[model samples]
Target: MKPLALTFLSASIIALTACGGGDDNAENLTTEQVLSLARNTNSANQNYPDSATNELLMKTPEAVTYYLGDGVLRWSTETQIPLYFVSIDGANPPQTLIDGVAQLESRLGDIFTDFKLLTWDVQQYRDTNASDENMGNDTFDKAFFMAQNNLSEGGMILSIDSGYYDKQYSNNAQNMCANSSIAPFSGALQILWDKTGYTYSKENLIWTNMGNNHGCKWNTQTVMHELAHGMGMYQHFEPQFGSWSDGAFDVLATLYHNAPGTKWADLQVSTL
Candidate 1:
């Protein structure tokens, strides 16, 4: 349920802001800049100075809703792409990734609806190692499932393709593009690189090493990030809009959240 003429309306509104208006939210582009007045924490970077109360920033404007869930994107409408999530093993629940999906559907019913989850109570989905050679094939399997269900070209699926999303999957929609025919949003999809090991995960959060040193705890964040790409972020190349170290939230990073010590504000459902 996409908004009515949302593209045209937003474009005109953005043009007005360029000419100047009451766009206060447009002022601070960096998280550090966001909390310039608040006393901050030892930053992940000198310039970023990670703040306790800092509003987590993103790489894309669409990411705002992506990372923050449907509740946080200020201008989000009642329309959204109905996503069919592929809950693989590594990115499962009680760990935040899978739990976050249900939460989003439960809370942000306006933008997302029609929730269906695959319960692998017996045989857990494969949690591929970070270096699996068949990573691409695994993603293709999920794509095949969607195809079997007759998922329309416009529908979306969370493809835990290989750790790197540089390959094309033919008619499958992934959130790896900056203006890509697929997702196009900068921060749309996360090609997880085991934040623990600091390298790309062949499973891309689709598999878990039982909480050893696998990936970031924010699995759901990655899901929404890619969803934003499908929603049309169109760009993730802004040098100044990623980390406060990089600068501020842009279309790319906006797909995820950065709030500290709290997942509440990050997972609320009203904004999606």
Candidate 2:
């Protein structure tokens, strides 16, 4: 709600320009310079005034399939970390999103040493009831029901498709959503990101297309950003940089303003 925070959101969510070969000028810029662009909306700061803003830019909405009934496909690693993969209308998550999470976990190393994660394909499951039209917006309600029906305790669900993703959620931006709630009793965390739009709901996890080259170069950072929220890193940290007029800031601001780097790996779970 702060001016700087809104500026961060505006630059992160709405204003973005795709670069040639998806590289932009990032190849030549340092980490600090990129962070500068994310903080400033003025075109003067960037060579490619039309360049995409921090993190992944959102794609436009298109027709997508969905699974009918509410159910979840669960999987885990050799260590037994519960990982659930969501599907809608027979459409499962893209390998890129799941793989990205793996990559992030590996990068975290000791941070999530106790947490090993992995997901299986819906094709391997026989009980899945695929259908379109059943899953829509109001994802919060659906997540509550899914948690009661699937997960006896409560957890998170990642969706590759199905939800209420439009300009309203995106604030007319192009990126999708990755919303979550810190409260456990409120059902489970719902995430939504797909091919059409990238809007995430707080109750249930729903998403569409995800993979390498989908958008942005900070896939690992984006994954970590959402997951950290799951661990209750919901509030933003405003570290002083310049004058008070400089505006708002948060500890996780880098997730939106910069690409994946050592700074992320440097994060301590206790700090969250």
lDDT by candidate, in order shown: 0.27, 0.28
TM-score of each candidate? Answer: 0.33, 0.35
Residue 15 Cα positional deviation in candidate 2, in Å, after optimal superposition:
15
TM-score for candidate 2, residues paired by index: 0.35
C-alpha RMSD by candidate, in order = 17.0, 16.1
In model 1, the runs with Cα more than 4 Å from the true position are 1-27, 30-80, 88-95, 98-109, 118-144, 150-154, 159-162, 165-220, 237-272
The local distance difference test score of model 1 is 0.27
Alpha carbon deviation, residue 76, candidate 1 (Å): 11
